[model samples]
Each structure stands twice: as structure tokens, then as C-alpha cells.
Target: MLYALGDPVSLVLLLLSFVVAVTLHGWVQCLVASRSGLRGPAAEGRTRPDPRRHVDPFGAVSAAIAGIGWAKPVDPPDRRNRGALLRVLLSGAVANVVVGLGALALLPLLTSSVGSLVTFLGPSRLLQSGIEGDLAARALLFLGLANLMTGLLSLVPIPPLDGGRLLFGLAPRSPGWQKAEYQLDERNIGVAVLLALMLIPLGGPQALLPTILDTLAGPLVRLVTGA
Candidate 1:
């Protein structure tokens, strides 16, 4: 059940989660760009911050609707740091996974409190207690599942994703696979876009993904929080 509160706690958490996700996305892009020799002027140690130097707008918006998002890309790192490209490329997805795990850990605390508050607030309040409770539960569930999905999805061996970077890093050493690896990066954007469009018809933001996440998170929440 939901408690009627003037405080914007839900809004705050939502915004914070978005920021965390976007920042990780940006850092990952920066790492990948540097490794791929796509550095902009800023990477040369220029002092000015150029908004233009960051983000693929189409990609970011698509992510937002799809429960994933990207930030503006950073200039590539210095050549000295280039050797760490694979690590950098994978870092964003790694960060997302970490967030997912963290959410799972924290789910009990969030759900218990929200559930209790909703019940205590009673049913006649402006905000229906039961609905609020469900939303809060769903939000926690989404946080964990969204992060997990983002991490896993980005690992697909397509360009602009973490998997693509891993494939490139490994391909050069593999006998006879170099040409195929090179072709992957060239079509990364097209592939990613196609995937995003396909996902949209599968239920937009509110359908199957959320349902799957809630289903996965439910048992864990009940086990930990005794809900």
C-alpha cells in the first residue's frame, strides 16, 4: 500500500537511478571511442567542455523509452591509456551489473518500508494504498532487472556495445577471424537500431520486460523481506 506523502522520494530515486545509468553509459562510450581511435579534440587535453563531443542522441532517446539510456560520449583517452581499452569498454556494463546486484541487495529494505507505509496509510486516502505498494515494489524490481538486462544486452557482439569491443580485442589474435570482426563494428549502429525497434513492438516500456523483472525479483523480495 502507498502512503500519501508530500515528499518526492519516488521522484528522487527515479532521477538518481537514471543519472547513475547514464553516467556509466557515457564512461563506457568514452573508453570504447578511445580504443577505436575515434578521439575528438578534447582528448588532446583541451580544457573546454563541448556538449557536441558527447552522446548519440538517437541512441540515448531509444534507451530512455526502452528503460536504458546513454550519455554523451567523452573524448577518447590518451594513448597511454589505450592499452586498457577492453577493460574500459566493458566497464559500463560491469557498472550496470553492479547496480543490479546492489538493487537486489537493497530490495528487501525498500519493499518492507514501502509496504508498511502503504498499509498504515489506510485505503481511503487520495492515493490508493494498494496501487502505491505495487508501484513501489515494481520500481525496486525494475531497478534490479533493468540493470541486469542492460548489462546483458549490451554484451551482444554488435558494434557500439560492450560485446563488440570484446570481439574486436580478441579477433586480431585469432587466425582468419580478423575480417569478420572488422565488419561487425561497421554495422553496429544499424544492428542496434534494428534491435531497439524490434523490442518496442514487444510491449514498449510497460510490458514483457517489466513483467519478467517483477517475476524474478518477487521471490527474492519475499525471501529477504518476509513480505
Candidate 2:
């Protein structure tokens, strides 16, 4: 069955999902920072809560064009609490993982219920034929998968990502570990750029990652829709 404004609706849903995912990512970071007693930029009078303070223009544009976005880096709190820093760094990735799991759990229900509702609506032949429930399913599936990918990728053992933080946090607090941590920070920008470039292919509609996400999403949607 075709939705009357399927394409528009899908676009809206995708954007909304992205915002929600990113917001959750931020919130988790804040919460972890607070819990770990990490002073944020705000604590140091260096920034405000506004996301603009954390916005990276290049990242935003890249995300708009490529669907991979990033937040601006804030100055680390004046008092360096390694534990707190680690928590703040890891929080966003953890949020994404949580959301991804939830999406996967809810997917089957969404697809099945939506499928049935569209069928029951008895829309016009043209509308029904055009709605492309499969497409909608694919879109949502990709959304969930996108979250999962973001979460997993952040865990890569490279500079600036959550994995790097985890590595430093777990390493012994010796001169060698401290030196390694400093090295990681020094090269974070380059590492992030390289990783972002490598991930470009994942953004394509027909990419293998998207296809995998759609496949995983299908069952959850069917379950949700009771199809």
C-alpha cells in the first residue's frame, strides 16, 4: 500500500530520527560527565549548553551531504578527571547502542501493524500501488541500523572516538600510558578524518551496510505490524 505522502513522510521521519538520536547522544554525554564529576566547558566559563557551542561546521555539512555527522569538541574541563573524561566520551556511543537495540526490538511490531493498517484503509489503487510499504520498511530499518553503526563505529580503537577513551581509561596510570594518551589526543583530528573518509561508502542508499540494516529491520517491522 502506498501512503499519500510517503516520500515526504519518510524524509520527515528520517530527519526526526536523526535529531532524536543525536539529542540522546548529547544527553548521555552530559549525564556521564556530571556523574563522573568532569567539569564541562560551562563549568570553566568557556561555553554554554547551546549545541552551537559544539557544532562543527564541516561535520554538519558532511552529515547533510553524506549522512555522517559529528559534534564540535568542547574544551575538556579544567580539572582533568580521567575517569570522568572517559565517561563523557563513552556516553554518546552507549546511547546509540541502547537506541539501536530498542529499535531492533520494536521493528517487527511497527512493520506488521503499519502494513495491516494500510491494507485495511483500502486506499485507491494508485495510492496503494505507489505507497510501497517495502520502501517504508527499508527506510526505518536503515534508521535503526544507522544508530547501531554509529554506536559500533565509535568503539573503534582510534583517537578521539569512544574506543580511544576506553583504552586510555583502562591503561595503567604510568608514564608510558600517560604518554600514549597524549599521543592519541595529538593525532585525534587526523584519525577522525581518516575514519570519516573510510565510512563514506556506508552512507550510500544501495550500500551493503544499508542493505544489511534493511534486512535486519524487516522482521521487526513485520512483527510490529502483525503482518
* lDDT, each prediction: 0.47, 0.50
Error of 1 at 106 (Å): 0.8
Error of 2 at 135 (Å): 10
For lDDT, the strongest prediction is 2
TM-score (C-alpha) between model 1 and the true structure: 0.53
What digit string (tens of lDDT, one per residue) describes model 1 on residues 11-122? 3444344455555555555555555666553354222322334335654444444444444324333435545666556666777777766665676765555334323331
- 123: Cα error in model 2, Å: 30
- Model 1, C-alpha of 162: deviation from truth (Å): 1.4
The root-mean-square deviation over C-alpha atoms between each candidate and the true structure, in angstroms, is 8.6, 8.5
Best by TM-score: 2
> In each prediction, how many residue pairs overlap at the backbone (N, C-alpha, C within less than 3 A)?
8, 19
CA lDDT for candidate 1 = 0.47
